[model samples]
Target: MFKRVTVLLGLNADAVADHAKASATVVKILRTLTTTVQGLAELRNQLGLGHGRAAPSPALTRHARLALNSTVTVTEFVIDTWQDRIDRGKLPPCSQ
Candidate 1:
């Protein structure tokens, strides 16, 4: 989600305020998702099976983690790449 948002922000590189707001929203959503992940993990632990709880099938977990890591990497890449423009008042002024 954050990476998607970051990509969108980069596409709007000529617009500053909108990009700032979009970045803030993405950060908020990421925080919320992190919290949700923790809660889900707690719930999974609480519902342990009588015979050792089965792990998520490796195939499913593998791609899910990879996707998540990829997203974070992309988000950081966007942030690092454009942060100078954002800070130096280089982005174009918002329209309308």
Candidate 2:
């Protein structure tokens, strides 16, 4: 998903060696967003939500809810930035 986002932003995912690259700004934002998503994935795994566990799980606490909200916010920002670039003709429209 991160790779796809980078590509959509006209960045070379493979060429991103560091945050100082030409596409660093957008890449860094995407990387941070990716990390947030990864954390959520890890939390899910820890809660046994990734596998079929017979044991019942506890309810989501405040921290979990905050994490979910943060992830959504970052995702929306990335999508909005991409769309803004497209709208400004800075990026090509996605191919059908």
TM-score, one value per model: 0.34, 0.59
In order, the Cα lDDT scores of the candidates are: 0.54, 0.69
> In candidate 1, what are the lDDT values of residues 1-96, reduced to their tens digit?
544544544533443365777777766655555555455455445643324757643345665565566557655755664675567675554468
Q: What is the C-alpha RMSD of each candidate to the true structure, in Å?
A: 11.4, 5.3
Candidate 2 residues lying further than 4 Å off, grouped into runs, are 10-30, 92-96
The 10 consecutive residues of candidate 1 with the worst lDDT sum are 7-16
Q: Give the Å error, residue 64, model 1.
A: 17
Candidate 2: RMSD over Cα atoms?
A: 5.3
Q: Give the Cα-based TM-score of candidate 2 against the true structure.
A: 0.59
Q: Which stretches of candidate 1 lie over 4 Å from their true place?
A: 1-18, 50-96
What value of lDDT does candidate 1 attain over all alpha carbons?
A: 0.54
lDDT of 2 at 62: 82
Residue 93 in model 1: lDDT: 40
